[model samples]
Target: MDRWAWANGLLDMAETLVIQQRGVRLYDGDDKTKFDSGTLLLTTHRLLWRNQKTSDCCISLPLWQIVFFEEQAAGIGKSAKIIIHLQVAAPNKESGPYQSSKYSFIKLSFREHGQIEFYRRLAEELSQKRWERISVPQPVPAGRSQPGRVKAVGIVGIERKLAEKRKETDKNISEAFEDLSKLMNKAKEMVDLSKSIANKIKEKQGDISEDETIRFKSYLLSMGIADPVTRETHGSGTHYHMQLAKQLVTMLHAPLEEQGGMMALTEVYCLTNRARGMELLSPEDLVNACKMFEALKLPMRLRVFDSGVMVVQLQSHNEDEMIASALETVSERGFLSSEEYAKLVGISVLLAKERLLLAEKFGHLCRDDSVESLRFYPNLFLTQD
Candidate 1:
């Protein structure tokens, strides 16, 4: 808690907002604190929290202070949380809610349920080290000239410097894309350039593009796989698939979390290929790679449903939790068709039906196949007996 600093909620130069969540509570170590029910904002440089009622009361913690973090699943009567372990507080740390803490960590309880996506984005920011890239100008002493430095003093000088930089950037871009061979050779540089362009567009326009398809394509391009495992790179056969499976697990973790911990194999194929850019993966190769997910004991597994719908889901996805949620929804609504439940839950009709079938299999719900469509009701047999 001492690591936090009081702030006026103003972003630093070059800093940008990544994500935000409402109804979040900050925990001082494991104990409760007065900083309850606030909005948590994740930026490139720091994690800012402001009271929902009193917006003026805001505090921030630098991203560089974080050592690591993990998600704590929601439990009975408790909200989900992100446990952020921190390094020792700096000697010159700014004032915060607490002077000292027993534990070297803090928790952010997500009451409104956005921990998964927040965690994913947080991981990305940490891996990127965006804070280190931010070069804040240091104040110089009153009448001192810094050695080996020439500042752009006037408008013409500034314009000349900007023009030179733009010319160099344009030259680099042209050279990188002069031919297909050059583009393939400079793939890593291209990815970095793509991300920079996307970030600039997002900063100015709030998104890379207005069109949905274009926006999605831009997103995929921004998340390019710098070192994708390919047959040519790793050689063919079982060894190649094994390496491919490991890479897929790392690449798909965030996407799976965003998709409610499960995604259809076909959707994964499209996303993977798009992210890979030129190197596309065939359906057969994708299936072969996914089959090794279980054998390798990765965090995700490939499951082929009875209906032949294959999906990749996190191992932490609990069947009991899904069943309980479905049961509670059905109990509240009295009865729900698959389509109705899908609309309510914001999931596909196929997944909704699968959940309903699983609940029925567990005897928590009973299905009624009527003329209109199949509907499910709370299992009265379990309640009556």
Candidate 2:
């Protein structure tokens, strides 16, 4: 889990194991912080306390431990349906205790809450805690005879020979470093050589970098799904697997432009690598891909937001594409809020904000505070310059 730990366990939440259907709303008859009536979805993995109109965050619950809750729900209905009422109860928790009410608690006393059924469905799902422990089935079958799984036609695979070559190269490089260290600091010229190489490459350097990037991108595209990093090894043996893991991530960057000129670099990494079948990369490679794109003038960037989430931006992505989608979004909904824009773009709020900011600068969009940094239909922002 070193890969997981370094990436802030970004993958942990990636597969929450808990699932939901139909959102719920939370509202207060009169908003008060301490005493509220909003409903929360309690689960073996998390306490998905939520408001329907907005996304919900599932707070985690410990397994096999006793927890005291201010309240809990027994069942749901409008006319004072059954409630667990943990207001004065000590909750029992366990890791898949193979029984009901063995995991965690949810409190429903917040008066600001909207409805209770949302939490009710949650209770029903959690009551079957053993089911939640089961892994989601593979989307497609690998082949030949599997029950409860659709036969999947061939997952793509990357070249192991190419991978091994890369690995051997890496190993050689590592050994070279060790040997060089004994040579009394002869490595000082590495920086000068790299700069000299950069200078010598000049304009062509960008072209070559870009060309190679595109080449690899095409390679990744034609590439079948990557082999699991565990193909031979037990647990991802080294950093080389990490790079192979990032291939899908670098590959998907192009598609992001249409959404909003951006994507979460971390998310892109997760999704792309996931598509590659659980091979993964270090955050450093993710950063490197962003930098490579930036160096190539690909309108892509590694944005460090005030919120501190990192994202990849694609400036070259057509505004017409986003605006085209935006037109549909607004047409469907009357006006696109920041929340709606993100939904339309299929990206995070941080990326949505960057797209809005870029649009405002480019005259392709307009924003009002009511829209909360969201923009619509362009005006001539370019006229000032």
Candidate 3:
């Protein structure tokens, strides 16, 4: 069992584990208060550091409270320390000039053996938790003002341009001019434009610092399935698998776009499981669910290569387009390797090999196998020098 399972055993309430590392010690980052030994756990919603000796003294940090993290290298017999910066919100009724910004910090130490991995995983979980907290809506307390929602700063310019164009046309004619469908389409366009601006901002900010890159990754991961169908909700039956398959297909749109419209089944499994959280489905279950896609007439299909490597691709994904592109890539060189094809195709080398084999099966390409390496070329090139 994982350290997270051990930690969950200690908890009285149910929680979803994100990441966990053992043999951790905590200290107050501000005063360097007396150290406490424990195991560190990151859950879907909070950071937990539990004292191995005393259960009552465990410390919890919510995602909304985190601001940043800093690390310090360690010497012999000492583990590396991670200083987590947090901005705890002050009570609304207790406002005064004397009240500080509510900044706090905590330090955690772990063995030097895999300190880098520990740090990376912690940062990843922290970033993802923060984004999830931001993206998901939360209930407001009674009599408290709701927090302001995020809006694309570029939307103002877009609205201004639309208004100017509207003024140039007939201004007197105004009676819900657009039908419901047209209005919905216009709203979708505005939403797409806003998303584009947000992505551009994220890209620019990510280039500024390594911290921003981590933050960007977290934001991307937080775009998970908001309403994942599970055995509990949909029951264990064909109907459940059918619903799960449909949801999976819908959720795959963004990932498919990122991977150039095709993705390895292994990658799909990992992403789906991560999105499922504590209600993770087994690999067999996922495969079975995917198998129903064809029967359900979803836009995606599961294809198994001769090598037994499986992939999920859009029904509209054209093999001829892929073959044409691959041929173009190797036209001048007259040869291509899986590595080169992978970079061109935005897939793993193993999956690229399968693609090459598929093209060869279609008689679009020919392969040259040697003791040193294997290469592929357009089938027509076989007759040339």
Best by lDDT: 1
- What's the residue-level lDDT of 213 in candidate 2? 71
- Which structure among the candidates has the greatest TM-score? 3
lDDT values of the candidates? 0.85, 0.45, 0.68
Ranking by lDDT: 1, 3, 2
The C-alpha TM-scores of every prediction are 0.44, 0.29, 0.45
Indicate the residue-level lDDT of 118 in model 2.
37
Clashing pairs in 3: none
Deviation in angstroms for 272 in model 3? 1.0
In candidate 1, how many Å is residue 204 off?
Answer: 14
Work out candidate 3's RMSD over C-alphas: 19.7
- Using TM-score as the yardstick, the better of models 1 and 2 is 1
For model 2, the superposed segments whose C-alpha errors exceed 4 Å read 1-225, 228-246, 249-261, 276-279, 294-310, 313-316, 319-334, 345-347, 370-385
lDDT of 3 by residue, 147-183 (tens): 5754324879567646654753443245346566689
lDDT of 2 by residue, 1-385 (tens): 0000011111132133333322222212112222122234444444433333433332222221222322232235422222222222233432221233321322234232222433444554445443344332323436755666543233322254345447656866998989979665655677678788678668675467776778866765556364533312221223433433344345665567444466777677775665555445557655655565544555455667565767765656565665555545554565556666777667776666655555555555566664354445444344355
Rank the models by TM-score, top first: 3, 1, 2
